[model samples]
Target: MTEIYFNLLGNSRESYRKNLILKFLEEKAGSGTGELSSKYIYYVETTATGKKIYLLRPANLNKGMDFTVHLKDVQFRLIGPFKDRPTHSEIIQDLILKKEENNLEYEKVKPLINKLFLCQAVSDEEYRNLHFSKGIEIEGILKIIKWLFIEQDITYWNFSGRKMLYESLRINNLV
Candidate 1:
């Protein structure tokens, strides 16, 4: 089981906080057991307990604007054996469609989109195709823009969207 929290600061000035924590974990955890680098997602596994975790953080700010965000929590239990841990795609799908049925409008959706882009789950060509599709609406475009600018704030870290996606992978033992 994992508990996740999204503490939104006034606008997005504190966005770097997320990076700080992730970097700390990565350095302590050591090389390659699943990293959340600037261009890749982070994956964690506990050798003894055989537990796994993933995490992602996306932030947005408007100079002086104030905003609030939803804090998310997830719990995962071993259904059978440790060897049969859920696949990454399965976990992501579950996270995406969980109770938040209205996630399409949630502020976090933008960051998720950016994470997906880094994962190549949705390519630029696919994005353009979707954007031009007849059924797409203006609101959708606005949503895309909202994610593109604010969600990818870590571009300055030279970590690209992949790092953000890696952070998205976490198992919240705290919950």
Candidate 2:
């Protein structure tokens, strides 16, 4: 009877360990930071023992195997895997939802926009939208600009939006 009791306990403990490992892998796979460069897509993997491993592969090639790349930490960050890129509005909404204290109102954001315009970080046309534009629309434009800036990609605009975003972030101190 002692052997039977041990068998039952051992099986249950093994099943519990497997379940815990599966949960950890699922969580990491779902929300790990990813990067898309000109040639490769990079990702970080953490082992069960908490060791970080950087991996990379051709950005456009699906059949290529993942190659390990050694790096302390990649400075660039994408929302998640390259499978999906979130929209600017979605990013802003997520931030707002994450913290209710984010001061994203038009009145608060307008000064930042004006400051960017004065500093020439944004063009005149980009700075001033339509005279009849609503407060929400203007706020959204600024938010999008900040998102593009944070992403550090100039594909959207000729000039980098980093300066404008940094200045605005300092002033707003959004959560």
Candidate 3:
């Protein structure tokens, strides 16, 4: 599974947040977790005001789709699937070279993630109805990020010490 999130302090003057995340990911990809880790490293993209958004996926999971990100309060869509497995560098090149349309498989999902995970919005019946697309459940997506960041302790701070996101998931029975 792949996970994406909006950085909480997105437009702050400290532009080095992006560099720090890249450096950490690069080191982990190169030597920290070996070959498999490199295969599934995280990718980040920034908005015009310097807010950083990110994505992560496991090597064996979905190849993921190409979608566009709108940072006017953080929105995304899964336009289509990838032709081949993409590396972190390849993704960076694509992002730098063009307006990269990336993947997720559902158009409305990421904003929902922002709301539930970052904004700490309480989930309700309407949310459950909207959580499925082509047989994929949003629960799996939530689990992926939770495991990687909270359980694995990779950039654990991004998820609010696992408080907001985890409580939202548990309340909604999504994890």
Candidate 4:
């Protein structure tokens, strides 16, 4: 079975986080088995602010699978800014009513919807459900970011260590 790993940090101004992560991943990628290849690693920066995001997936996984992972990761990273971000219900409502009108698939959209709910990022909910464990919440967010990037065909560069993942997050409407 394929496994995913994530390391999340609170806001930090340090410039080396992306490079540090890239070096660590490159070392693992060089192992050549039971780990993602360097080619499968993708780095995306927000178009406006330049906050960076990193994505890793096994070479063998399908594009659809990879896309889901990217979305989860992006959602997780976005949670820090909100007193609580949009809830799963609110996101789903928007997707179904608006985003789907633009031709996005509901199945492809459900995971992100669920993730937003679980993360307590949705500020619209009147009563919060704190049922999900912290570990599950983190995993869900990582998976979402992975999926979103793949689906959106977001531009990503190879692991360069020179660019930080946070830079990607700083850009555009992605946050």
lDDT of 3 at 106: 36
Which is better, 2 or 4, measured by TM-score? Answer: 4
TM-score of model 4 relative to the true fold? 0.26
lDDT of 3: 0.34
List, residue by residue over 1-175, the lDDT tens digit for candidate 1: 1234332222341453354344534432333323532222233212112222333322122211111111112122336433222333443444444314443343334554554443323333433332221221322332223233334453433454434433544331100
Give the Å shift of residue 98 in candidate 1: 29
Pairs of colliding residues, candidate 3: 65-102, 65-103, 66-102, 66-103, 67-101, 67-102
Candidate 2 per-residue lDDT, tens place, 1-175, comes to: 0010011011232342343233323322223234422233333323222323332332233422222232223221355643133334444443444234334443354465445333334433543442322222332334344324423322212364345445544454432
The reply for model 4, stretches above 4 Å from the true place, is: 1-4, 10-20, 23-26, 30-94, 97-175
Q: What is the lDDT of residue 172 in candidate 2?
A: 46
Displacement of residue 75 (Cα, Å) in model 4 is 18
RMSD of 2: 19.9
After superposition on all C-alphas, the RMSD of every candidate to the true structure, in Å, is: 16.2, 19.9, 15.8, 14.1
Least accurate 10 contiguous residues by lDDT in model 3: 63-72
Tens-digit per-residue lDDT, 53-165, candidate 4: 44544323453223222322234233344312233333333333433243333234344443432332322121122222222232233333333423332223244321232
> Which window of 10 residues has the lowest lDDT sum in candidate 1?
63-72
